[model samples]
Target: MNLVKRLKICVFTFALLFIGTAVNAQITNDITHEEAFTALLAAKKNAEDSNVLVNIAVVDAGANLKAFIRMDESYLGSIDVAIKKAKTARYFNMDTGKLGELTQPGGIIYNIELTNNGMVSFPGGLPIKNKDGKIIGAIGVSGGTIEQDRAIATVGAKSILE
Candidate 1:
């Protein structure tokens, strides 16, 4: 082949290789088992520090349960609530409390809680985000008042960033 033709072929081959490699380099964002455990521990610690008994739950990017803990003496009613809260955060990519505000009467998403197999529109759930600010999972806490639950859940979600 002529010199110019050979050079053109070489450049084309390099471009093809680069494109293939770039496609294969795509990364998936999800929470690891260890990270979920760390978040649960942080939430539990926050509950203990506040002298509160609570149920904590962690869910992955797909809103699937990863870890759950119910402190001794915690209200039994909070079991499902904790899981739902985590799912709610992951589903909406925002805090459950914020959803509550938006779903209230006269709000933009009024009555939205009636959908999605039933969502908790109250406090206690937060989305866990990666260093790039992409949500990778969520944390939820229940068995306490709204404020207490929100506080504990916030601590758990923040742990993943630290």
Candidate 2:
């Protein structure tokens, strides 16, 4: 083959190889239920450090509740809100703030926030991802201020891989 033709063929082959690798690299591993509960308990302990009465909820990627806990004196009113927020995080694979954005007026995905059974459109929820970088679950915290809730959820989500 001529030099230019050979160079073109090599580049095309390299491009095809790159595309194949990219597609395979997208595979992911999911977190287990045990990891989800462990993360929740650890989060609870973290929140306890601040003397915050918090309710924590964990949900799987499919937005199904996996585990839940509320401090003995936590507000009952926050339980459902906490669970829903957790599920929302898992389903959307992001933090609760993004979920809020999705539900904001004029947001393209606004109506989706209303589809889940008990999703909360507020912060304090975070998606849980495994080593493979696939989000497999989420954590939510409530019974405190929104900031405190977000802090607790952050701790919980971080604990999953620790």
Candidate 3:
């Protein structure tokens, strides 16, 4: 490459890196262990009250697993689903149900779940938000019917709000 071209490329790369770092630094990861635990407990309780067995997963702002619980008699196959659902919620910063709607055939971004290392786009995933409406984490539940799972996850997500 010419000297001028190489210099321009280097400058462009540097600017991009600097901007990414600055933007990432501004995003606060306030999802502590306590918050994750609270979400898990709340979700578990909801499942119990509903007489549903379920697996629950919680993820921090970085989309890393923070907490998980598998209730007695929950389907073993649902463990991975729960974790992936939580990750899917955090990865897109939206409820997985919404993702499901968008990924449906004829909808925008159809088959998106094929990407992102295999996401679960169905219901049972929710973003945990603070009172200010900023998402701090996410929760996912599985093993129950779609409605039951979504309800349980919502209870979990709401418990730690703010």
TM-score of the candidate numbered 1?
Answer: 0.82
Model 3 Cα RMSD, 1 decimal:
5.6
lDDT of 3 at 116: 76
Give the clash count for each candidate: 0, 0, 0
RMSD vs true structure, all candidates: 7.2, 9.9, 5.6
Give candidate 1 misplaced runs (Cα > 4 Å). 1-27
lDDT of each: 0.93, 0.85, 0.92
Can you list the residue pairs that collide in candidate 1?
none
Model 3 misplaced stretches (Cα beyond 4 Å): 1-27
lDDT: which candidate is best? Answer: 1
Better of 2 and 3 by TM-score: 3
Candidate 3 lDDT over 1-162, as tens digits, reads 899999999999999999999888755756889989999998999899999999999998988898999998899999999999999999998889989999989999999998979999999999999878888989999999888999999999999863
Candidate 3 lDDT trough over 10 residues, lowest sum: 23-32
Q: Report how far off residue 74 is in candidate 1 (Å).
A: 0.5
